[model samples]
Target: MSTEVISQIDVDRTRGDFHYPEQHTFDAGTGLSHATIDYISDVKNEPDWIREFRHKALDVFLSKPMPTNWASKDLENIVFENIRYYLANAQRPTRSWDEVPDDVKRTFERLGIPEQERKFLAGVEAQFDSEAVYSNMKKALGDEGVIFVGSTDGLRDHPEIFKKWFGRVIPTGDNKFSALNSAVFSGGSFIYVPPGVKVKHPLQAYFRINAENFGQFERTLIIADEGSEVMYMEGCTAPKFETATLHSAVVELVALKGAKIQYVTVQNWSANVFNLVTKRAVAHEEAEVKWIDCNIGSRLTMKYPGVILKGRKARGEVISIALANNGQHQDTGAKMIHAADETTSNVISKSISIGQGRATYRGQVHIPKHLKGCKNNTECDALLINSTSRTDTYPAITVRGLGNSVQHEASVSQVSAEQIFYMQQRGLTEAQAMSLSVNGFVNDLVREFPMEYSVELKRLIDLEMEGSVG
Candidate 1:
């Protein structure tokens, strides 16, 4: 491998797609078994209780079968036995960037993580492969009694808080992927906001998959105490590889009384990656929870960020944007469950399919018969770029109450030759016109994203449209 300087993350060949030589010191070889689970737990030096938890979760994972019914037949391709469960160069995360391995540090530097942390983020966690290379929280936040650290540290240092909320939002047995993540999870964020304290800036995490034939399972949990507020953002990327890669993560959020929590994710995976993720939140009395998700590249991705409105006057919202180009499938949506009277939930989803790619939206909203004064709204829109592109939507909503109400809407549209020609006539090239039109279709939703991610979305769209116009 060359140590030559790479200028930028491009689209077709090297779109944020480059890798360094592997120098791993810990690897739980290629297979899924009891030995693998024990190896992971022993390496982490976890307590006996946690080791038992992983074993039980492994049983659940083995009991459940692949989800080929709804996740497309592609689920059959994931050979769990061939995936290396754990790979890391260090036993624990370093608090200083200077302490990170040179290659790992360069990876973050190239992705602009350090600069972003200095500019806006209140804290940043950089995870490589299966472990965090660097984790740091702003001194100001620590002074305010806010706990921001990797999940491993959370369990070891703040057991009282970590044990109280971990897996409460999304249980290990909730699904097969969640169970898998529980059994072999590693580096992810764990945050606890003290009551009545609001973090002024966002906390961010960057997950990079730098190895081949590997599985990266990270678990994250966040709890916002009474009247507190927080916002978290995550970005993911992987280098293209000939072998398939797997990334399964479980994320849970808890917004206590009158608190607010916002979670955002932008996934730009390689085409050889299978991105299966499960994320959900719980909102208590007068609390609010929101999920902002963007999916750009993957061979197949299935994720639905849900919220359980468990208290009166609670609110939940999910706004998602997904793009599938060439050989990719973006299966994404939201779930909202109104368990209390006066609760409210809303969902807005938009997807774009280009080339032979496919995008699907799956939404579920439930307001039980006992719930009164609850309201739910859902809207899904999809765009098809070329004749070969594909999109699908499946929404299931159940409402039972006189005072409660629910509204639903869905639309699918394609970029007509007239629309592209209209732009091309204005001195823009064909590819440029197509890019503009695609961006226009989703500009409304893009505005909901923070400025930096919005710019990244546009750049990804432009790159995908290049040479795609026939």
Candidate 2:
């Protein structure tokens, strides 16, 4: 395709409407204390053991100081006492949208989750504030040995499976945010596919932040048994508030022997949100795992989706795209660790910065010397819409063993006036021309998304580009 077409493809066609929810009252108030943690546990009616785990995690969260040397400096300004730890919109997940509280149902309806779920998804869960308001699974998927529900429901109904893998991939003490998520996390998806089963349609979850001064810490877990396959998608949005809100989440995935798993996230939180999330997966013998991550609209985002090749011949791939607007900073990347022989991994990352926004990529690819026949490929590209926008690339590679192959490439450039002029000459508006160029920049990665999602993503990007023109 021509450059014009390529760029146009990057621009979304959907004129995205900004729909903000009316704020509500939900508070546990003031810092990481025993009483606050207990209040959260009691609100959820969680079992004693799980509550104990939360208290332990809360201790860890308090003991660890914020790491100042990391991706962004915004962490230092976050006030722990200013965030509401929990809010329950519903006592339990519901199978019907009508069964959800009218207010919460209106929230998801405005966000398009219900319509999208009915048209294309196999399962859908909608979370309002810190709890899932509605969750439903198609009968076909239930008959085919697929389980999809909120993490809370999983803990109550599938205790054996949930207990075995809850903290296996990402322990509570793995990092400060992980600890925080473990302590107060709520309203995330839980998925499992029995061996040899395949979920043909995607399972989706939507997260909405409807309260002011609230923190949304959601923990998600997915397991694909041997020879099984599944794909999951997540969408996030929040009301625009003057004060910054916190959204720290942990997501873990396990792809067992001969299984495949794909996890995709399309984050469009309001610009007042701090999106600090930890996501990682383990690929066992001959297993495959992929992360398709898209980031946009957050005031600051520091996320890195990683994978571990634990068993021989496992494969991992990360495809990421980030779009940063004025007053926004997107610092995102990926990590790949090769622990066994014959493991292979790939990373493709793209970013776009407009107005005064800045985007950064920090990544790692590690292959221990003891591992043989391991290979990795990494590519990162950044596009700046103007001179004021900034982009940075940082990649660390450690190769220990012999016979390992690794390749890395990176490029950064501002949009070309010549290209814009050429596109305008072809009958497109300046904004449309810019949109087309941005779309083309990440066309390949957009193709990896489910058709419905790709279409929506493209439209969102286009709407973002509307007023971005000088």
* Candidate closest to the true structure, highest TM-score: 1
| Per-residue alpha-carbon lDDT of candidate 1 for residues 29-93, written as tens digits (9 for 90 to 100) | 99999999899888888888888989999999999887655577888899999999999998779
Tens digit per residue, CA lDDT, model 2, 83-138: 88887755588899888777777777767888998799999988888888899999
Clashing pairs in 1: 10-15
What C-alpha lDDT do the candidate models reach, one value each?
Answer: 0.91, 0.88
Query: Once superposed on the true structure, which residue ranges of model 1 sit more than 4 Å away at CA?
Result: 1-14
Model 1 residue 156 lDDT score: 85
- The candidate scoring highest on lDDT is 1
Compute the lDDT of residue 270 as modeled in candidate 1: 85
Prediction 1 TM-score vs. true: 0.97
- What is the model-wide C-alpha lDDT for candidate 1? 0.91
